[model samples]
Target: MTEGVPATAGSTRSTSEKTAIFWLLAGVLIPLMNIVGRYRVRGLENVPEAGPFVVAPNHYSNVDPIVIGIGLWKSGRMPRYFAKASLFRIPIVGAILRKAEQIPVERSGNPRDGAGPLRQAQQIAAAGHAVVIYPEGSLTRDPDGWPMRGKYGAVRTALDAGIPLIPAASWGAHLIMPQSTNRLSLFPRKSVDIVFGEPVDLSEFANRPRDSRVLAEATLKLMTAITALVEGLRNEAAPTQRWNPTEHGQTEIGRFNDKR
Candidate 1:
């Protein structure tokens, strides 16, 4: 809500487009999720009303994306995600991604596809839109659902675009579907909560080259913001040190057993 901090236009998906997607998707998902659990959203006003902004959230469960997407959709911002290129190759889903113009990220080091999504994110933001990114890249490995370490994509895109970055936190999503599994459980309806925090002040870091030093500092600050929000939601303090997958020899993108 600060001056010169947020955007001045709706997401690239015009109001009608957002509505169409919202109702179209919600009509099916709302009732399905409601049957599974209730949703409680807070601090939506903290979301930027205009321009290109980044929504950075901690990842914990598969359903959380749907929950977050609904929250953002309700706030008039359609989200573009940094989905894996493989998912974009699926049949029906791939068709949707192509039509929506979502960004595809290549996790492998093919050199040819390096940093493709990050650069695309900057261009998307520059054109006046919003993107939702999981700074952790994937679900948390913290058995207790706390946010682990963050990647640089979200913060880098914000800094590169000179746009406000909002840190979002969600709790009770892991309950919708257990960790490391996609099996849906609707027997017990749970409460899914999502909150959006104030934009991280990175004006000082703007215009700086994307060096290791700058990305590291910005990544820490961004994670700190997101962790604080999750801490508030959980009403408990997070560990002083973030859990690092590489250091622990765990996978970053999927199940720990995943060697990739």
Candidate 2:
């Protein structure tokens, strides 16, 4: 395997343990990312230098995963995403994702079927890997770009694995590729700000039954932390109430509107 960037101070893994495909992708993508956007990363010290942890971030754009991936990479931890299973069926992309060991998430209406990915993610976290899960599940439907209601996967995974759950926020990626549009603006060189917040305190929920009420409360606490981080980056206050797709009769996944 090719030697990658030096591991962060407390990380147990060495640079040489990175997969060849990961390095290859990083070699190409990192430079491209720099050219596309100026990154401003902060609060990396909040990340546990070593151990399995789940980082949940607010999602608002199609390019979020790429930007957040780079941010975590700079923080000295290789990010393993819970990517949509559909992407794992693509030609070359799927092959690379598999080789990179990214987890695949299958979206389904059946609760049993949907639990599979979370179980796999918990196992991965237990084995001491950094897992990045977007608690929102999909891009935010909030009109002002604030985070909407979040799902329970991130909290469940962290609580089950008994690992710290870190809340993260990324701002300005939507300027590169605005929501509801396929166009890209590489000229102005937007500054993408990413901030990692301290691990959410789940002690109150620890050892409690993972019932719907408990999970919902824990998920809200996690999302609240993420929104606060985002508020700091934007220098604006989020709405008192989070946006809910169900209340608005909008689909949870995919593009709901074409307003760019």
Candidate 3:
């Protein structure tokens, strides 16, 4: 873990063994997914050996975060996700997620529960944990399935926390598990690929406030880098299917655009 950040607010849980078990499961799961789908990763060397860093990846499917999280776990880092608070209500599932130390992001548009996701991420990074952020705040729905506009939370976190930002991209997950449904399919033999780019530095804003546009600009550039990575992985290939946003519980904009 990196130094200089404070401890988590109320985490009394022990993550050491859980992390170990998670890695063990991810090891088999990731490789199995790869072998079954014939996927491979390129640019795994881009992640730091140790970190107080943020991982920004393009989001296209619900499985995107799990894939990226497992990938990072296999690479020797504990991935802490900043997920919506609503997910914390599911019975046994919520308990597991809580023990995993995933940060809860209250999306009621309230700013009173301490810092927003960005601020929470900064605190986590400052404490030496690796954070994953989807700048778009949700999944993509482009006819071609490219990354869409991203929110400013990621930029704010990276700037305020003063950590390296790594751009990551994932391909074929949308097909493996469609964003519109909760079921996995076995039809397509496509391989999922995750590409991590070299860290983007923003040392110039080390001491800046969490509200600067510079943070948003930095996030935009990071998003662009992730998009480029995804584009490369796709090799200009077309999506196997065009999912309807309504089927996935998304709004006019949120349902169709690339999230995270």
Clashing pairs in 1: 7-50, 7-51, 8-50, 8-51, 9-51
User: Mind giving the per-residue lDDT tens digits that candidate 3 earns over 1-260?
Assistant: 11333234333323453465466656666775664365566677887665467788988787788778766865677788987687889886677667776788776545454266566677777667778988776677555567766666665676666566788988888787887766666665767888888776565555566564866666667766777787788787434343445565554332334332
Q: Which scores higher on lDDT, 2 or 3?
A: 2
Residue pairs clashing, model 2 = none
**lDDT by residue (tens digit), candidate 1, 99-182:** 666798887745356378888888777767788989888888776778988878888787766678899998987888877678
Residue-wise lDDT of candidate 2 within 170-249, one digit each (tens)?
Answer: 99999998887757778878899999998888888877999999999999999999999999999999999999878877
Cα distance off (Å), candidate 2, residue 189: 0.8
Best by lDDT: 2
Q: TM-score winner among the candidates?
A: 2
Candidate 1 Cα misplacement greater than 4 A, ranges: 1-14, 17-22, 109-114, 256-260
Is 2 or 3 the stronger prediction by TM-score?
2
| Ranked candidates (lDDT, high to low) | 2, 1, 3
Candidate 3: segments with Cα more than 4 A from true spot: 1-36, 109-114, 207-212, 237-260
In lDDT terms, how accurate is model 3? 0.68
Question: Please, what is the whole-model Cα lDDT of each candidate in the order they appear?
Answer: 0.79, 0.82, 0.68
Error of 1 at 169 (Å): 0.5
Q: How far is candidate 2 from the true structure (C-alpha RMSD, Å)?
A: 5.3
Model 3, residue 47: C-alpha shift (Å) = 0.5
Residue 25, candidate 2: C-alpha displacement in angstroms: 1.5
